[model samples]
Target: MKRLSLITIIILLPVIICAYTYTVKQDGTGDFTTIYDAFTCYDVQQNGGIIYVFPGVYENVPLFQVTPNSVNIQIIGTNKTTCIIDADYAFYGFEIYNVNSNLTIKNFTVQDASIAGFRINSGSYGNTIIENNNITNCGFQANASVQKSALICHGNALIKGNTFIDNYNNWDYWAHEEFSLGGAIYIDYHDASVTDGLIEITNNDFIGNFARDCGAIFATSNQVISISGNYFEGNGLLESTINNNVPQYCVIARFEDCNIVDFNSNICYNNESYEVQMGPSHEQQGLVFKDCTVAQIRNNTINQNLDLSATEGIKGIMINATNDEGAYNIINNIVFYNWDGINCMNDDYGSLNIDYNDIHNNPPAGGNNNYVNVTQGEHDILYYPDLDPLTFQPIWNSSTKSRCIDAGVPNLFDDDNTPSDIGAVCAIKHRIDVVDLPSPSVDNGLKWLSFPSLDDVYSTSSYDPDKAGDLLFDILFPFEDPELEYVKHENNYFVRQWQGNWQGTSNIFSKTNGYIFQMNEAATLEISGFKVSDNTHIKLDGNSYENWIGYWLEETQTLSDAFGDEWNTGNIYSIQHQDWSAYYSEGTWKYKTS
Candidate 1:
């Protein structure tokens, strides 16, 4: 008997699992009308499934708990801002009970809940992803104490790209001394140090949340906790005015006893009380063993916390981790306009490395501005960052450049292939084309393509391969056929056929030219490059019969804005998406359906 090759064996070893997807529409056109009834179906609840909710205001939503044996579920909204699941201050958000199945909730406005927005109870082993949501006014208690707020998570969870606003812990008038867990998110106290207990909270926004203790996040985890790329503003600024004695201990995040804390690229602005504190928890009653954190806190920008009238705005970052094993490196950050800059004074573990930071404007009578409790570091500087007040990016329009332009450590570099800046602000790319693959033709897998993001100036010379996934889209053995043929229309139809493992001519690829993709299967094409433009100015081929034009405009625009003065004069175009067209005749453009 002949044995199979390793590649063929590996490909055949995988099992193909079929998944069911249900759509919930408010207009009674989809598979289900209500979000609750969609999950309650026997086929969706017993087996794994996906539910897509359409754009509408869904009212009076109850607490949706993950039942036993219900696994691998996803509830996604059509639009992030429009599709709303309004709880009406009556019920809690979605909950995951003691199940080892994965659950994902994305792109919804989960608003006005009485308890946690997305609660993951203990005994959950699978991953829970809560992404791209607007969780507002959830997680509230009437007269109770020790209440956990929005996005209360346990086990492996990823909370990313969510905006949380005004999710209070308790609404009691006289509970000023009440012990609050977390205002926006409480990692429901670590559950016994399992190896698979990991949680990552990244690229989220926390604004105007309230707790008696921590006003934003109070995370207690034994897993590797990574909180990065988050924006925190006005946390602890909104509080109950009836009894306002309790101070917001940590305004942004209070991480307690994590295994590894990689806190990077966060921006905290004007939040009340201490911003981003990491220390051992006081809940263990001074018998903590696995609490000394190995932290890498770098490239963060903490600015202008509280007005100091509350007297709780103490430190920008108060890192109290007595490192038992690994080191704590605090580098390349800008801590400005605070009561105190940093208080990483505790060196009982003797592994505190603090350098290359800009700590300036500490409110005149600020607290510890030292690196080691007594003396300042030699690498720390007091310089004006010259940042934009709104976006927090470095000011680049003026002749005088910002001091944080190229001030980071020499080994590190920014995402723009330049020397890294000091603060959390990074440059956003000018043009990026993230388009899904167009629908495949019924007859063949051939598709029409146009490079909307390719720069004509950059493509004239050599191109950067790393700018996109690949500049030439990997001409090295990508085609299914040994000799694959592709055509592009420039002055004339130029068709080229190349064999496998041979790089084709790169000059035929241009944004001005349209091509036919000889693809074997459908796949997403990612293209990002550096090109500053208001709108694409296309110089159409005058000699050619027709021109293929493509422009990357995010929003809808008038036809005149795109083609300029030539829009209505004598131009004719066909929209491939809608299969509609408008042909110019006798100085008039008339629409026609195919």
Candidate 2:
């Protein structure tokens, strides 16, 4: 045989060493049927490539393990909602241990694992991106001795646009044990070898998650971390039966030995425990820098986080720092409607600056003394900021507009104009446009709306044509019986009567403009061309409304104005669209729904 020339061998190598692309489809129509088959068949060690999974459920596979120094790979899905990797039998959905780098997992739903959805072990040190995935129902069957979470990141990672829901860890697998740590996400440094680790968690939704310590997220000993623009709702709290009494803090970032930690622009509401807890616990906060060198906590909206335990009530922000050299800045945030606002325990050495914040209405019974622990800056407002009921944005009024306008730091600017309002956004003036309403007409009336139950009931709003300031409205309906008695009041308003829970008649007053209605529960009412101003807010029972309509157009106009008396029960109605022309131009209001 004749020996091949150098030019002939070089040309053949280019065709042989090309990267491979594999498609894993559940329907046996692709290159591989299972994800494990794709990993085994592809030349991952030499030439790493993409494994695109089609839209279907892939179940009963191994832990989808990736070894150390493996080829850089991407496991992508056709759709985040449809493509599901259900590792219900395995300990974890994806166990990446000591991987080199450039591992990307995106756009899939990973659920029902015993330990965790994605477990990135300690030695994995690379640029990792975990985005647009739903990690749910994990960590429930984890071992008693292990600490588990839905997503555990021990490497430098960027986690964004993911939904973590209904993930729980067992309170105590053994009798009288303190075991579980995080429910949704846990970020920790395993050893000193992994230095300067950076993790950014942004724009994710954490809902209905549970654990012993932190329900949403727990971060410790990371060098640099930024958590921003995330929505955490209805998370935290141990089951009522568990006996563990440890202080369960939600969204904890205990950076006892770290540098540069920023928690900003996050919306944390309706959670079960403390909204945020940062810094050390035992030492004097002002004397020694316990955890973090520099910390910036700004522009976060924390509301309605109450203690799950009746015996132990919860507070809003708990910052315990002792570093004189480092600075802890809590500025431009809205800490409202909790048991307490900001409790800062700082030693003489630590520099704790609390300024330009709206801390009010916490523990409505307690006076101003329960608001702020530190001596706030001159611009900080203590009274109710009068946030919009629906959007939670600051309304254009005396209480909110007077003190918060132009109050933030010189560098930061509000959304509206030069004068920046406190909290997340600046005050923008506009009218209330009914963006959506429950469709099929029946699902609109007589529904139970509460935290974690009707939590997904959201109606969109915007500032538009009417220019009616910030519009807030209340929902009213009779319980048990559909028949309601109406009496016209003196000021062109009507007082409607209905049977109460205590075998007594309850009376509600209607507004003259035909939009606002008075009831026990404070709901974010949607009315076309309505403006929300001064009104008394009353907290009602969890199951309050029986026959709820969006708004009562004319109080004396009877059942027809209340979106019709006949409604189909047991069917869920979703909002289709709001007929703007019908309400604005014709004066006859009608909400079009499917």
Candidate 3:
């Protein structure tokens, strides 16, 4: 066989690349003017590549379909806010059926569809990524009687960092039957086993989505599902005229057969119904097995969930399981300020282990009637966690730190060196130093001034001992007579004495550089010879005096050298600069001139 020359090989390489790229712009400037046109023109089965959609509104288009045998095809929008796909009267926004793996749809605003925003059929089984998109106002059909969702994924996928809002199904609005499963997302595996890799839903935000059943998410017949770091707010709203007796849930995962579900590090707040309703709600939750084996619910913050009915019972976490073979581990969570904290009903068949959780302020916190059978763990606290008002994070206040610090399980470690905190956020300590003047004391014929006390100083310092000792000085004396005389005492100290007629020369005490000068009127005097830390809160004569100091009264050090960590630097000093305008440098005091 003859080998091809270098020039011939280079010529054929371009044709054999097996990938093609196209662009879609609403303004007819890109390779294609519409997204439907790009999909129809590209031979995705033979060469799979990306279709980049610029920022613009593409309206009234058919379903953006990914044909079968299309592998590694990505439809990406430039921006989620600006790149809009408006399917006002279309059946669906995107339909991926029996497609090859690795299909990614990201960074787009998909809205106004009749059926759903994205529908991934069962045959597609790659780690498809649906991320950074805004899915809203879809799944509204009055005539059709079918369950609807913003996104329906039958294949293995990772849905992360997406926003689902205002998506609803109005079948109940016209017809008597309620056919709404999930307003935001629905994950269905039909009959697939748990061996399929888990479908991960992480870091997504679901808000204001409404449905009859599960408003935010509904997962059914899946092997393993991991839902973490997601925020669910104001979901699970039931129509007023419709059947209000049906239970509405923000997150519902029901597995008919044996499976493991891990739900952790999520925030579910301000929803209109149950925050989490897991396991089969049927069977009256007796001793019979419903196939779910392991459920780990930990590190979540749930709060303020209310139902439409004024007298209804709302729960932050409601687990109804009938399987005696299953094990439920609920630990290290914050379920506070809600209507009910953990309602575990029909959990007698399963082993319930609830421990290390901060559950407080709920109407009736954690009861067997509510489905929480806390057999082994410690009871939840009733005090407030002292969370930050703005961020809702646990602040470093004494009430929060004393109870939550190092309060997790025996083996698990917190972010700090202590044990884990009993909530989603760990407590971190912050140090602040305060300095202020001490009270004056008199002994014999002399009066002495003491140094200021350091407040909230916890640990020992590595600064020089001599410099620390020199921070205290005695220099004040009382003068009661009309004529005052200057006298020199032992240890080079100076004193003020009463004279009958005349006073010593002005230059007598002037020669002593360390003597305190007594003045009739309030004058600015410079006094120096002490070391202090910068950034310290200083007070003089029982008043705040931080503005009069020229330079840092305390020695400055780098963050690494001061804290032994690279996060905080500079010493904080609070010095009271009253009538004296003075500062210290190199262990010496100097008065500032007016």
Residue-level lDDT of model 3, residues 497-541, one tens digit each, is: 435322322222111122222322222212211224445443322
The lDDT ranking, best first, is: 1, 2, 3
Candidate 1 Cα outliers beyond 4 Å, as residue runs = 1-18, 57-71, 122-124, 171-179, 237-243, 273-291, 308-312, 321-326, 345-347, 364-374, 427-594
CA-lDDT, candidates in order: 0.65, 0.59, 0.57
Q: Mark the 10 consecutive residues where model 3 has the least summed lDDT.
A: 505-514
Total clashing residue pairs per candidate? Answer: 0, 16, 21
For each candidate, give its TM-score against the true structure.
0.62, 0.61, 0.62
Candidate 3: regions farther than 4 A off: 1-20, 40-43, 59-70, 122-124, 173-178, 240-258, 273-291, 307-313, 364-376, 397-402, 414-418, 428-594
TM-score: which is higher, 2 or 3? 3
Candidate 1, residue 65: the lDDT equals 43
Instruction: Compute the lDDT of residue 270 as modeled in candidate 1.
Output: 81
Candidate with best lDDT: 1
Task: Give the alpha carbon lDDT tens digit for every residue of 34-62 in model 1.
Answer: 88888778787689689999999886443
